[model samples]
Target: MSGHDLPRLGSLAWEPALDRPDLLAAPVLAALTAWAEQDERVRTQVAVAPIDPDHADTATLNAVHGLPTEASANCVVVAGRRGDDERVAAVVVRATTRADVNTRVRRLLDVRKASFLAHERAVAESGMEHGGITPLGVPAGWRVLADARVAEPGTLALIGSGVRRSKLLLPGDLLAAAPGVEVVEDLATAIDA
Candidate 1:
């Protein structure tokens, strides 16, 4: 089946992954592209879309593109410090749920406190746009913590392609198995609509 044949992605205007020069320019995205090329599971499953950089945020993107909230996922960079050492993780959760940073994340990192990484720090460290820090190509040694929901088979997760101008759509299980990624339960708490 063609990439567009993937469920939940047929509605979006997806361009061939190799054709997106804008996405390949970003270091993190470039890394992801290389990784996908090497991994058959990801090479056949991923799709990319060029979007308005301004609407990259989940709420606006969903409203404008008519995508379901559940199909979109958010990648948040979280940091915790233990004395001289710092631990960083990219937390992936569905847009409908918020990462449990204070409790679950802190416990996982074994740090006294856990909080979202500062915007500048996140961008500088990941070498990606602020609104597009995906877990796929974060700095080596950083943990990628994906919520269990993101790993459910057949779930199409809309996530950042490491740039605000584009997004990636792929099977949740594929993302969960990305290099150094860990699928954790209760990583996020559902928000009441």
Candidate 2:
């Protein structure tokens, strides 16, 4: 599909992700392929577009793409341990907010403490780039917690496509309803943009 057929978001030239698997990281491609067959929204609405890897950071991306920071979502990896077992979760929040890792995340994981996963470990475990880990293809054992604000009506989530070279854009409800996603209230605290 060409840019004309893709969902319009920001100023990027969007294209159908399934038609340009090269724009997606391996796990992301696989997840999309599967979800397309299982969910109508995934097949019809998800779109991808190339981006400058150097500008993949949320602030830079929003600035370059002419999107409000609230239109973008950030995914972060967190890990906590209880005894010898560890629980890992991918928390998604609007770019203007921060995940409550110290209390909410730790409580959600039922562990005494939760911390952001090391960049290297996150990249290695998720099989995605350091700045482009997304909730869509995170390991099945890990939880995906999207802050409720992200699923509010009229929001479009600009998220990593598991690679720094491209981004995925879709309605927030699509992400909220994606398989294994849990919408949690007050999961993140808003920060000034």
Best by TM-score: 2
| Position 138, candidate 2: lDDT | 90
TM-score of each: 0.92, 0.95
Question: Scored by CA lDDT, what does every candidate get?
Answer: 0.83, 0.89
Which parts of model 2 are misplaced by more than 4 Å? 1-6
lDDT of 2: 0.89
TM-score of 1: 0.92
Clashing pairs in 1: none
Q: Which 10-residue window in model 2 sums to the lowest lDDT?
A: 1-10
Candidate 2, residues 36-107, lDDT tens digits: the string is: 888766766788999999999998988888988888899999999999999999999998899999988899
The Cα error of candidate 1 at residue 36, in Å, is 2.7
Candidate 1's clash total is 0
Candidate 1 per-residue C-alpha lDDT over 1-193 given as tens digits, one digit per residue, 9 for 90 to 100: 3444533453567864555656643665666667766676555567788888999999899988899899899999999999999999999999999999999999999999999999999988888888988887788878999999988887888989888888888888878877788999999999987
